[model samples]
Each structure stands twice: as C-alpha cells, then as structure tokens.
Target: MFIGGLGRSGTTLLERLLGEVPGVAPLGEVVHLWERGVIGKEPCGCGEPFTTCPFWRRVGIRAFGGWSTGLADRILTLRRRVDRTRHIPALAARRCRVGLSGYTRAYSRVYEAAAQVAGGRVVVDSSKHASLAFCLRTSPVVDMSVVHVVRDPRAVAYSWRKQITRPEDGTPMTRWPSAWTAVHWLVQNLAFELLARRGGTVIRVRYEDLLADPPAVMQALLTRLGLGGVAVTFLRQGVAELSVAHTCAGNPMRFAAGPLDLSRDDNWCDRQPRLHRWLVTALTWPLMLQYGYRPRDRRTPEGAVAPWLTAGVAAQECR
Candidate 1:
C-alpha cells in the first residue's frame, strides 16, 4: 500500500503504526530512496547509512543487480522530470510519453525488492507525493493501493512553519510560509482525490481521527485494503511497538526505537499566530468542510468528523 499525502500530515507515524502489523513492511519514502538514501547515502531507519545497511544492500542487489551512484543519480533525474504537481494531470490521464514508463518500472523495483526482503505480503510506502502515487498506481509490476492521509490545514500549516531537525542527520529542515503551505495542502489533497477518481484504490484517513483511535482506524483501513485478517497491536495507551524497519528516507522519527507514542500534535492550536491561523482556514475552507472540518465557530464538541465517516465515503470508520 502507498501512503499518499502532503508531508508532516502524519504519514510517518501512520507508516510506523502500519509497519507493526505482521505482513506489512514500512519503506519510509521510496521517492527519496534513489536520491537521498542511495546517492546521498543518508541514514536508514536501521541507524546505519543506506548504502551500508545490510537490508538495503540485499535490496540493491535484488532490485538493480547492485546499487550504483551513477544509476541512482540518473533515476533521480528521471523522477524529477516526471513527478511534480504540474505533471499530475498528464499522469492521471494516462498520457504515456518518453521517460514516464521507465521511471515507473524503476520505482516499482524498489517496492518489489522491499517485499522480498521484508517477507511481508504488503509493503507500506510513505512517499507522500501524489504524482508518484499515481505513477505507482499505473505500474504493472506491483499492485498498489493508496491511503490518502489528510490533517487539518490549520494544523498542517503550523507544523510546516516551525523549525524541525531531521533526526537522522541532525540537519535543520526548511520551513515554508503559512500561505504556501496552505496552497500545498489544497493542491496535494485535490490531486490525490483526482487520482482516486481515475480508478486507483484509495481510502482517506484523517490524522486526528487516527491518533484518537489507532487500532480502530487501522482496522478500517486494513479492511478496505482487503487485509482485514492482519493483526495490529498497540503496546499500551498511545504507544505502538516498532520493529527494525529498513526504510530508505523519511522523517527522522522513523529512526526512533522502542514503542512510539501515537499522540496528536495540536501545538498549532495554542501557538500559531492569529493571522496565520485565519489565513489557513480561509484558504482551506471549502475542502475542509467537505472533509468534515468545520469553521472555528461551527465546530462540534467532538471536533471534526472525517468525510469518510459523515459522507458515507469508502472505508468509513470514524465515530
């Protein structure tokens, strides 16, 4: 299954939670697998850098005969040309052209190899890019299902505005303005919706709802993906057990060991500037309402009702 959404919308956390299930292998962000993980030699979830990790070494051998920096760089270049918000419409329309099919086949090899190494029936890829998700959906090498993860735009904007350090490298990641982040939230969500309508098997999940009830949300998600028999265990309240996931690249949080706390990050509600909060809400209003996020004045005591829950959409599980 592919986890598609805007970054920082809880894709990493969801990947970790899903990875806990017996037959699921969470490959952090395979969009970055060739570039950041392989070429840049960034650290894998296993602590060792990607090129040095035994699991990745095995995957490299299986997928590409051997991992080569030159080959990785070429693939990264091809990925850059095809995977973009502007190219999403062409991809969804199934407009086959030069370079598109090659990228898809190359990308599919990573997931196919991951499944081989993980020994799992399902591989969870939290790539979080709509264009890439569409590409995977079109690929013949792997059967892909998409989980479109959405968070409140206000919360997402606030998270993007804050300074965050990559846990793997201790490098400070860049932050975008509230306005830009809001626009991204809108476009990315719409793109995923468009892809779903174009025959991709997609199920949307709200980050807040997932945090409120992980097992229940996951049960609904797994059921929709037709893996209803898979078991997911939470070690305690708000904590999930994590194994050694050989994910290529993602939030540094993927490197965290032991049980993970599955709590919601609502710091934006209390700390975001008034102007920024209003801006995000105004820009995201229509789609927000469609997804069960009400205007501040109209919010219910129980908070937002996910679209899947209230609209009788596919994979309804929120309560």
Candidate 2:
C-alpha cells in the first residue's frame, strides 16, 4: 500500500500504527531510500545507521547487488527528472523511458525485498508523494493501493510554518509559507484524487477521524486492503507496539522508540495565526468542503459566505 499525502500530515504516525499489524512492513518514505538511506546514511528505525542495518543490508543486496553512492545518485536523479506533478501526463500516457522503467524495477525490488525480510505479505510505503504513488501505479511489477491522508489545511499550514528539529538528525525541518502550504495541500490532494480515479483502489483518511478512533479506522483500512482477517496487534489508546522496520526515510518520529501515545496534535487549531488559518481555509475551501470540513462563519465583503466555490469549478480549476 502507498501512503500519499503532504508532509507533517501524520503519515509517519499512521505508518507506525499500521506497522504493528501482522504480515505488514511499513517502510517510511521509500521515495527517499536512495538519497537519504544510501547516500546520506541516515539512521533506520532499527537505531543503526541505514548502511549498517542488517535488514536494509540484505534489502540492498537483493535490490541493487549492494547499495552505493553512485547508484543512489542515479536513482535520485531519475526520480527528480520523472517523478513530479508536471511529468504526470507523460507517465499516465505510458511513456516508459529506460530510466523510468529502471527506477520502477529498482523500487519494486526494494519492496519485494522488504516483504521477504519482514516475512510479510504486504509492504506499506509512506512516501507521501502523489507523483511517486502515480509512478508506482504504472509499474508492471507493483500492484499499488493508495491511502490518501489529509489533515485540515490550517493544521498543515501551521505545522509547516513551525521549525521542528529532526530526531534522527538535529537538522531543522524545512518550513513553508502558509500560502504555499495551502496551495500544495490543495494541489496534491486533488492530484491524488485524480490519480485514484484513473486506476487502483484509493481510500481517503482524515487525520482527525483517524486520531479520534484509530482501531476502527485501521481495521476498516486493513479490510479494504483485503487483510480483514490478519490480526491487528496495535489498537490500544496511548499505546502502539513497534518492531524493527527497514524504513528508508521520513519524519524523525520514525526513530521514536517504544510505545507511542496515539494522540491528536490539534494544537494548531488554537495556536495558528488567525490570518494563516483564514488564508488556508479560503484557498482550500472547496476541496475542504468535499472532504467534509466546515467553512468558517466569516463573511465576504458581499455579505456572502467567504471563499465559496462550486465543486465543479473547483475540480476544473484544480485540473
């Protein structure tokens, strides 16, 4: 299963929760496997550096004969060139260049190896990139399903505007302007919706709903994935069982050890600047409505509801 969404939208938390299920391996952000895991040698969920992780070492050998900086660079370059929103049209047309095909094969190998290592049937990738999900959907070797995660745009904007330090590395996470964050949240979610309509199964999960009831939400998701009978071992509130996972790259939260409290981070709803909140809600109003988010009570100059847009027009504008 591919987890596609904007960063800081609880993809890491969801991945950690899902990883607790039997016969499932949650590989955090495999899209960055090449650059961060192989080249930069970041720490794995296993606490060892990515290069030295026994599980990843086996996966490396299986996926690429052995990982190398040169191979990592090549993969990263290929990804940058083709795996992007602007390149979606060509990819959708099945314009499979050699590099693109090679990358698909390599990625499939990584997933296959991960499944083998975990002794599991399902390989979960929380890449959170719509383009990567699109690319994987086109791969002959991959039968991809997507869980499109979304949080309130205001929350997403607030999260992006903060300067959080990575737990694996003390480097500060990149922050974005509230406007850009809102724009990206709108475009990326729309893109995932369009891609989902094209092929394969896609399920939308709201961050709030998931946090509200993780067990029910997770069970429903696993059922949709045809794993209804698989024992779900992690569901208790304020407790999540974790195991060593060969995740490639993701938020520093991936490195967190032991049981984790499944709590909501709705602090943004209260602490976010009113202007930023208003801006995100306005920019993402139509899509937010589609996703069941309520509009603010504020009115426009014309005494009409603020930021109103017809759903049809919103879909068209997104396209």
TM-score of each model, in listed order: 0.93, 0.90
Instruction: Candidate 1: give the clashing pairs.
Output: none
Compose the digit string of candidate 1's lDDT tens values, residues 112-183: 888898798889889999988877766777788888898888888888988989876688987999999999
Candidate 1 accuracy as TM-score: 0.93
* True lDDT of residue 298, candidate 2: 30
Q: Which stretches of candidate 1 lie over 4 Å from their true place?
A: 297-319
Tell me the lDDT of model 1 at 260.
80
Model 2 is weakest, by summed lDDT over 10 consecutive residues, at 305-314
lDDT of model 2, residue 103: 75
Report, for all candidates in order, the number of backbone clashes. 0, 0
